[model samples]
Target: MKKLIYCVLLISNVLLFNSCTDDKPIFIADLGSEKIAFTNNFASEYLLSKDTKNNIADRFIWNASILGVNSNYEVQAAIDEAFTKPVSIGVSKQTNITVLVSQLLELVDQLGLDEDPKTTDSTGKPNNSGVVYFRVKSKIGNGGAGTQEIISTTHMINIKLIEKVPTSTTCNPLWIVGDAIKNVGWNFSKTTVCDSDVQRVKVSLQNGKFRFFTAENNWATGLNFEYYKGKGYTIDARFKSEGAGDNNFDFIGTPGIYELVVDTSKKTIVLNPSGSFWAVGDATPGGWNFTGGETAIVETSPDIWQATFKFSAGVFRFFKTQGQWDINNNYAYYKNAGYTIDTKLENDGSGDANFKFVGTPGTYTVKINAIDKTIKLN
Candidate 1:
């Protein structure tokens, strides 16, 4: 019995020793070198035209390195060399990225460049060619754990602005009236004239063609505009009506809502494919009249629409387009009482759930962010 007890004690000691040796060593990655180099494809100047499809821009290439254990790469552009206001251009695993002319122009606009070509920089330098700086950031791990970010040297990029807007100006095209439009019957006066604020209008049409007009009723459709077929949303092949020509826009596809954003200063038009999101029901100001004032949600921002209308003590639901029940309808509601900021509401397929206003009837605000797929009620 003494020998058996001795063998059991020896086995327990061996088991404990093996358990202590089982853990693997934690590996810490290197923070990598501070310096990074870009490849030969980098250019000093890039010409940005309105139509960037046919034009080939600059493709930035760089050498890849093991910055850390799991190194990821991102590119950023900024107006200032110090990167005070940086805009992320691209983030990817690849070491190369093609900076499109359209993207470069967008970055320039976001950097608060003025519309006039003769605009000056802060240092009294002529900024006719919008100069921007690009750099690359190589990062490891997810910043929460073992992570390090290494930035590359700033590269100069002078964006040459072509297709400058002509000095001539025309009146704002408020409503699109034509036979191709679903409700409009080519009669401007009796037709439901689409309104515009800040030279932008949200137009919903079937698979048809239409033309823009300045007046709400009758007379003549002045300063009409037409889009090229292969131009996509950019106004590359835009043809404006000088006098006698009719420039009709052919919208052939699924019948949905679209937003026509016109920049008179730049002489550019962006017809974006968008959702016809709005609210309508007894709780809304227009009540059941979906096509009238209650359902007309204004675009407060790009793809973010809001309206401050009077709501009655009732319930309402959101839809992409009014009167098209089977089309783009979101038949769901916010659970509990209502939704706060950035609250994502669910779509109930064919369910009849709706948002209710339990408080007294007065002026209220409803906002729908189609880009983020969220709603806000105030």
Candidate 2:
């Protein structure tokens, strides 16, 4: 009986040792070959506006389930493709998220793409449009940065700001200096117009050359301006490339007393002829003048258009040409709101296509920006 008990104890101890040695370590999650990726295709371009701020810009979706673990998605945006400094636009526990225009605007503003038309990027493109890099940092938990995360492949999307005028605007004047003007030769103070605020001026220039300068006697390299794009300085075209090496506007046209206008809203400088954008209706003088320039909105600064007139409460619409009702610039073109600021910009498809001018009958300035696609009445 004693011998049998010893053998049983020795066998039991050996069995216990084998069981402990053979047991595997506690189960640790492994990513293995599983990875996260955006499933839905992204739009190549996104044009954002204040009117459609609530509208969804993009619905970012990705392949669901990471090792059957409940993970979170962090959407980030950066100016560069490498995402040097990323701004988290959204965080979602679900597999997808809807990003609003306002949300993207925040990123656009952060990226410095929402700047005024006067600003240009490093590549000389307007700051209003550029490529924004995006990526999804999926984390194993709902916690933010530094958590166990698996980042998805980066994708770039082009974003453009259509408008920036949320409030008041001031048109900065550009003096037509250089030896082109008959009397004023490179003297910025003999500026075509004495008042810096005045955008349009009649200056007499001899058959020579002239370039637009910012301030008095400031002949700095970048402070001057010339034609933008590859196009030459024609009768009526946008010409406002400031730092282009050869910045002289050769006045091959008839040299005499000509009206030079500096328009900031369209970033265009024009001579005499001013009627690119016009407002028409029974609300003002030259009521849809079967002719042009009667209710013409002149260019004050680069890309900024301005005009003032005595207005009565009535319906009006903007058009490129006079004599007919062609709906190019309508009330709905500015914003969907029935009214903006003080005027009633009634928005609809049917008969309310025109904007309603409200309030006291007096002189008011109308500012229109073609690039921004916005109108302001003040």
Per-residue error at 61 for model 2, in Å? Answer: 1.2
Error of 2 at 275 (Å): 30
Count of clashing residue pairs in every prediction: 3, 14
Worst 10 residues of 2 by lDDT: 233-242
What local distance difference test score does each model get? 0.60, 0.65
Candidate 1 deviant stretches above 4 angstroms:
1-29, 51-54, 67-71, 114-126, 141-144, 163-378
Per-residue lDDT value at 199 in model 1: 60
Worst 10 residues of 1 by lDDT: 189-198
Clashing pairs in 1: 188-217, 189-217, 276-320
171, model 1: CA deviation in Å?
Answer: 28
Tens digit per residue, CA lDDT, model 2, 335-368: 6533243344444344336677666777888887
Error of 2 at 129 (Å): 1.0
